[model samples]
Target: MVPLLKRFTVFNLAQCEGLDRLAPEPAPLPERQIIPAAEALIDATGADFRIGGERAFYAPGPDFIQVPPQPAFREQINYYRTCFHELAHWTGHRARLDRDLSGWRGGPAYAREELVAEMGSAFVCAAKGVVPTVRHADYLGSWLDVLREDNRAIFRAASQASKAADFLLAFEGAPEGQPAAARQSHSSVQERIAA
Candidate 1:
């Protein structure tokens, strides 16, 4: 007869002699270096950044990004992540990507814009070798409701997000011969939305 093996959802290694040695210890968080590519991309936008506040936001009227100071974050990477998210919103300025930024908080339009920002930030973070996390968990319900209402909502949001990411990334190591306006003119936000 074959010997039986037992499975466990929770196991106590200390219950068995010498089994404690086999238990794995938790790993430490890796030290991540600041991404210069992300920095260059942000600088290229020429968007004003105010870096000392409790909340993070992109003010489209003035075309500025405000983020809490670096020291306020538990992990330095989170600070950059927040900045990238706001920068995604900054791309929607009338002079840039020309997205609809007039949505009020807790509304459908707001949820859609938040989705774009979240995905846009993920794209930029991935390009810069940084992991992305959801910055707006409270919007989860609203996002789901929007998705449930329209089958194509996600596709539109994704297309818009890709455009936003591309716009920001274009600023990184831009060619000296091309002016910023000319670079931004290559894609029309309205045309993309209509597709």
Candidate 2:
């Protein structure tokens, strides 16, 4: 009984920590949406997760997601679940996907974060070879509530999460929205940003 109780407590605390990682703040704008173009792997698998058109987010947890092995990750696939979860969060960083980590992340903020991460995970799982685990139904109610409360939450979170997903799929050497030819054009964009 003691061991079980301790495990339960630990799980709850860890979940709280995960939620805190994406603390919200007020911003000048609602943040920009990041979208990746379709690729061969995306086409072959028939699993392109469209944002703006619908909702999106990453699902964390081992479960054998498929991707080429690289220096960042030891093996071809990761067994640790939370790592993927965080990687999913990291994808929303300003430099990569430019996801808004600020103000009222749509309601509980935490709930919106979870929704995006879960959606991203599910899509990546299909690409990498992991099975989609059971998503919590309890959150569905909260998610809907948040969406209803904030119409833009669904759109922003989905857009940001999609870009994050594309950023994480860097091993494929594919820049989400950056076309091979557009790299030069974006050079000016980058310069403007730098200025």
Candidate 3:
């Protein structure tokens, strides 16, 4: 069991303008530290990530994720990256962040959700010292379509992804030098999302 962020936490968006203004970037953690930190965060979510499936998906009703095992991936990092992507979807469960997950596969809403998961996974990987790859690079055309249709699409996706990352990182052992303003901004965004 890991530490949990206070549920229903309140944050102020106006004060978050300085979120990314940390004086100096913190030193990266050793490679060995990354996996364990990711595992801890996944564990903290209380969602089961099963390895028996060939396709990866988040089951909102069950509050669980299914991903293919390590051998199914081209690299070890990919396995966990996919896991985090699915975990981002897990955050959208009704009891968690409560995002709308009713879109059909390959639909506009699906592409939007994919954007959130990819960005959220990148944020989590960066937090844990893992360099993230564009796992869903094939989705770029669809993503661009969405962005073209709405100027604020990327902004909303990034904001939602940040909130998903913050929600999971709340279980990590330490804060990893993330600015309080940034964390608070993420919380504020989460509050907005839930509303």
Which candidate do you rate higher for lDDT, 1 or 2? 1
What TM-score goes with each of the models? 0.69, 0.41, 0.67
Top model by TM-score, which number? 1
Which ranges in model 1 have alpha carbons more than 4 Å from their true place?
Answer: 1-33, 132-142, 175-195
CA lDDT of every candidate: 0.74, 0.45, 0.71
lDDT of 1: 0.74
In Å, residue 122's CA in model 3 sits off its true spot by: 0.7
What's the lDDT for residue 180 in model 3? 45
lDDT of 3 by residue, 52-89 (tens): 76788887776778987656554667767777888889
Better of 2 and 3 by TM-score: 3
lDDT tens digits, residue span 2-68, model 1: 4797665875677678776577786654555467766666666667899886899988887889998
Candidate 2 Cα outliers beyond 4 Å, as residue runs: 1-81, 103-107, 136-141, 174-195
Q: lDDT score of model 2? A: 0.45
- Mind giving the per-residue lDDT tens digits that candidate 2 earns over 40-67? 3342222223222112233222212243
Q: Is candidate 1 or 2 superior in TM-score?
A: 1
Q: How should the candidates be ordered by TM-score, best one leading?
A: 1, 3, 2
lDDT value, residue 132 of candidate 1: 41
